[model samples]
Target: MKTHERMPELLAPAGSREKLVTAIHYGADAVYLGGANWSLRAKAGNFDRAGLRDAVTYAHQHGVKVYVTVNIFAHNRDLNGLESYLLFLRDAGADALIVADPGILLLCKETVPDMPLHLSTQANVTNKASVRFWQAQGVSRINLARELGLEELRTIRQAAPGIGLEVFVHGALCISYSGRCLLSSYMTGRNANQGDCAHPCRYSYSLLEEKRPGQYFPVEEDERGTYIFNSRDLCLLFRLPELAAAGIDSVKIEGRMKSVGYVGAAVRLYRAALDYVKERREAGAAWEEIVLPPAFADEIAKVGTRGQTENFFSSAPSSLAMLYDRMREIQPCTPVGIVRGSNPLLLETRNVLEAGDQLEYLGRRLEPETCTVRAMSAADGVPLQRANPGSLILLTVDPPLADGAEVNALFRKQHDRQAE
Candidate 1:
């Protein structure tokens, strides 16, 4: 394999065990995840102690790295619980600990001083001076604030060449700075810093008037409630070459709270893009991004998303309405059938599932897998039986299905489906 500059590490999200596998299988050089505690994503199906051990084992086995998030800003109350947690993470064999608190960093240095640390984006390490300080304090990496631009990132990359620079290459972008927001706690008593963000920014709004005798005006339209603060999904998949060229160590894809299919597709898409870049470099082709076709990316959106966008990159500004519109369906098709069989379980495609259709299974804690349809049933096998919504059918794969793993027998449609 030819090296095109040192290959950028494709860091992806791992919300659960299945997601961890998907991220690795689809193509992630490294993964960042929240533990059951001390992590930013409260809603994700985080790993318990044993689970973390297993996850780390699995990633390391696959020649991938796993980073645990201990990045939550803490208070005096949170400190007492700190030492035990740090010990647990270090014992679990995590690749590194991502932390934001100075006290936490100090404690980590004193306790597990050999444990590698990365400054969280929450640290808002916006300057070379802060980077130097964190490096001196023993932070091995830094996830810079979201507000930084290409120029700022390039400068940091140059200044902190030894320290790994990770960026939010994809996922939701908060309108505020560096995820430090009191909105959820301020409005609903649920602390966002503690992982219970209400996503108040995504909520629609209108002006309420008490003196006007019970009247309301749309905050933006006077009629419709607008998600004025809702921003687009950051899509740097097409800009792989630019980011890689900039000398960033890791291209971090956000979404520890996202679905397995979402995890699988995002990692796979970026992996393909990265490989494409490498291939271009090998062939001496111009290093331009070969993004997955729009329709191809649209398939990813079906997993569930606010629409995707290239946020804050171009500087010229673009309409972000597409991102805010919730009219687009999430999980576009209902999971209507189950795959049943053994001896290398064959997913009896009750419906004509096309190549890229992601198979979702309702497993323990909502864990799902996206197995691309490599081969379907032959004439001797079950056809699209036209069984109703809740039908059970038999099928087979190269390996038999596990005793009880639910798989949503997915089928593609025409145009997209027909081409498949």
Candidate 2:
């Protein structure tokens, strides 16, 4: 690696033990996961106590660090067992605790003094002063808010060069400042800050003025009203050099609730991008020559997403950052199968897989490989023309694969399948 090409750690989301393993196996340097409690992603398949221990052990065995989230804004009742939870995480050998609440931070300091603390993005850290203050309170790292621009980030880095700073280089972007929003709670009675976001921001709404009780008008003058608060998904794979130049210590990829395939593909894509930048820097090439590979964008698109946008990274974000017309992810395919065996490759189907259907196999630390399904048979050796969901079938593959490879269908953009 070149002297100036120190690659910031690529931190991926590990929502469960499976995700944790997938992230590490796919080349994530570190992973951040939420516990069953005190996490912002309540809908995610979060790890419990036993699962947390197993996850930590798995990541450590793979030479990856684990950061557990204790970042929820707590009410009086929520703080009851927080101290014990903190100690449990410490004993579980968690590398760090991602926290947002000052009270939680204080409690962590009082309870587990040796536990490393990472300030979560929910803390809305937007300046060096806040960074220094947190550092004084024993925060070793700060995940900066998404509302900051590159220029603001550069200034913060210049002011506090010694303090470690992380930024969200990819994944979902919150419309509110640092994700402090009342829309979810106000609309659905679920507090977003407490890990139960209803995602009211993604819902379409119309205008209902006073004295217009029976009338509804489109907010954006369209027939379908508008998804006013829907923010576009963030993508910064092409801007790794700028982030490194801005002195970012780590680059985080969000989406703990996403699929295992998403986690695997994303980790590989960002890992490749980081390696590409480091290789170019080591070659002593001009920064102008560093261009993001077109394939990188295509690979990212393979996973379901609403759309991509820079989202305040370049300049003041306008209407361009929000996707008004669509709300759900536009996935191009259905996850048909997952590899259960390497030798004489076996597949466990999530969706129906038919003979002669072209499939894409996604694996850890490797690019996706496309192959045609020539023949299929049940695990019992019965010849089959099609394998339904929950059926395990053996595939005749030209190149044998290692265990745990994921197989997905290559459906077109207009083709949409119900969630399996």
- Per TM-score, the best of the predicted structures is 2
Q: Once superposed on the true structure, which residue ranges of model 2 sit more than 4 Å away at CA?
A: 209-214, 221-225, 363-367, 398-420
Per-model CA lDDT versus the true structure: 0.69, 0.82
lDDT of 2: 0.82
Best by lDDT: 2
Q: Per-residue CA lDDT of candidate 2, range 298-402, in tens?
A: 777765477788887889888877889768555776667656665667877767777777776765433566667788899999999988888988887534444
Candidate 1 Cα outliers beyond 4 Å, as residue runs: 1-4, 222-224, 286-304, 316-420
TM-score for each candidate, following the candidate numbering? 0.79, 0.92
Residue 102 alpha-carbon offset, candidate 1, angstroms: 1.5
Clash totals in order: 11, 0
lDDT of 2 at 366: 33
Worst 10 residues of 2 by lDDT: 407-416
